[model samples]
Target: MDIRIKEAVDLFQEVMFYGTERVIKSIDDPLWKEFSPEQIQMLKLVSREKRITSSRLAALQAVHKSAISSRIKKLLQKDVIRFVQTEQQDRREKLVELTDRGKEVLVQSDKVLTDYIENLLAQHVNDEEIDQFLTIFRKLKDIIKADGVS
Candidate 1:
């Protein structure tokens, strides 16, 4: 293995440890206590996409439809999201959209994530390093995708 790759992996592990801790703290904060990290991600996607099917969402998150549906049910119960019958020609297809409350939660979560990333980038890292990190990560993604993991 390349020494640089090993060093990068070490850096990633350290950042993940601290970053996840901070984000979990934010999650546990009262304003966000009701939502899980995955739920917030789904909510944000729904808020922007306007509406999406569980099948599409599951594909996006690389999860099974049943698992996505389970989370969707919780979101519905919390009034975080709503199911809409697409007023289209397809009568059997249903869509999920974020409720107003869901959007609000997503916005809050975005702020937390943004602040966390910003802080992490600003301290002990520069723009060049950040760009390199994203490039390397994207390359890794391409390699994995080429392996037909999805």
Candidate 2:
């Protein structure tokens, strides 16, 4: 294997693990105290999709339907998400959407994360470097998407 490829992969893994850990830690405010990391992740995914079927959400999260079901149940109890009946003929398929409260939570969590990232970058990285990183990241994302990796 090429040394550059190995190094890049190592760095990517390190960044993913370390950045996720730090971001989780940074959101330790009272407003976030009630949520688990997994719950927050689910909420984030739901927010992005606007509405998603439980099965599709499980697939996206690479988990079994039962696991997603448990989380969905909890979120439902909290009124963070609501199930909407799908128009499919089966009639059993339900799609999950964020409630107004869920949207508020997501917004607040995003602000907290944004502030953390902005502070971290401001302290260590310049604007030009950030722009360059974004350009490269987007290009890499496009390449991966083109390859049907997701």
Candidate 3:
């Protein structure tokens, strides 16, 4: 591999670390006490899928079914999500759906996060730079998708 490629990878890793930490801190400051990151992700997934089984959510997330148990439990306890009866009528087959409160949380959190990032970018960068950053980010996303790098 080229030395410059290696240097670029290292720089990217450092930038990602710091960037992720800052974003997580900013988002978690107000919400972390109530919900863990896993719970939030689960809520988002359920909100998107409308109705999903625990095993299916684990599969979609590429995690073990047991790994999702605690997060699902917490969401249920918080009334963010609830189990719904499926047409199959199998009581043991865990099907879950988001509650109205969960939907509101998902929408509000998205708005808050978008506004926070947009404000931060606007404060430090012009529109052209923002567009350039988005272009590069989209290219990286495409590469990741092509490589199946979930």
State in Å the error of residue 45, model 1: 1.9
Candidate 3 lDDT over residue span 1-150, tens digit each: 899989988989997779757867887446655776667778888977889999888987779988888788878888889988887857678689999999887887777678888888888999899889889889999999799863
* Preferred candidate (TM-score higher): 1 or 2: 2
Worst 10 residues of 1 by lDDT: 23-32
Misplaced by over 4 Å in model 2 are none
Model 1 lDDT per residue over 25-77, tens place: 75445556777767877887787678998998999878999989899999999
Alpha carbon lDDT of each predicted model? 0.82, 0.88, 0.82
Scored by TM-score, the top model is 2
**Candidate 1 residue pairs in clash (backbone atoms < 3 Å):** none
| Per-model TM values vs. the true structure | 0.68, 0.88, 0.69
Task: Compose the digit string of candidate 2's lDDT tens values, residues 53-110.
Answer: 9888889888999999999999899899998898789888789999999999888888
Top lDDT hit: 2
Tell me the deviation in Å of residue 12 in model 3. Answer: 7.4
In angstroms, the error of model 1 at 101 is: 1.0
TM-score ranking of the models: 2, 3, 1
